[model samples]
Target: MRYFKGVLASERRIRCIEAEIERQQSRLALNGVEGGEQVSRTMEGDAMERGFVKLYDFCDALDTELIGYVEEREAARRTLDCLDDGDMVEVVYLRYFEGLRFPAILKLLNAGGRNMSERKMYSLHEQALCRLWRVIPREHRQRKSVQ
Candidate 1:
């Protein structure tokens, strides 16, 4: 569950960083056009350079976050694929990958002709996680042994 949650968190953080970068660029562009600050040329250059430095920092952070997100998401997907139960796979996929809460998961399941209660969905989620935990260690050992 923590692993799955981390992927979602990373994705959200990346989006926030991207939006901030865009805002900073827009503000810097507007600064050039507005021409109302009435500061010295050197001060203006300093401010602009600082803004770009912040933007570059954000871009670097975003690149790092994106790389981690892709690797984590792929590992999570591979783990999910190891599960034999389609229902369990769907539940995990919707909750983690799709970032849906329990209520939304319930709604989608029911819409797909699954007449399941919230409690049942919760139970299934627990079962899926339990299975995932068991599978992960075994999968890890298998890879290590092969190498």
Candidate 2:
């Protein structure tokens, strides 16, 4: 689950970065300068390109970040299939990937009769997160290892 969340987050980040790169590229293309002025403009364009390249590289790094989460999410899904129905998986996917809040999740769950407290809902969230963290790749772990 954590792995799945990490993948979703990484994908979202990648999309944002790509959009920024596209915006920058379009801006550079629209500069419309020529000759001597074009040389100076080209330098500025080069700088922007470098910046975009760096961001692209960062997006690539996210693939590494996503590796553990992918593996863990798959493993968890398999384990979960053995033990329970698909509801919890759906809830986790919607909350983490769709960015839905607890009240939203509660509304979605519609677990009737029992009055679910916000605190309890948050506790469930924490539990899911913990499970995710346990399964996330070493590289994707919150703290970086000292060199």
Considering every candidate listed, which one attains the maximal TM-score? 1
Full-model lDDT for every candidate = 0.81, 0.59
Model 1 Cα shift for residue 104 (angstroms): 0.7
lDDT of 2: 0.59
Per-residue error at 25 for model 1, in Å?
Answer: 1.3
Q: lDDT of candidate 1?
A: 0.81
Which lDDT tens digits does candidate 2 get at residues 3-116? Answer: 456656666766776676566556545655222243344677687556556656766665665675566546545533332334455567667666787788877766656566
| Per-residue lDDT of model 1, residues 15-51, tens digit only | 9999998998888888782333444559777798787
TM-score of 2: 0.45
lDDT for 86 in candidate 1 is 84
* Reference-based TM-score of each model: 0.79, 0.45
In model 2, the Cα lDDT at residue 8 comes to: 66
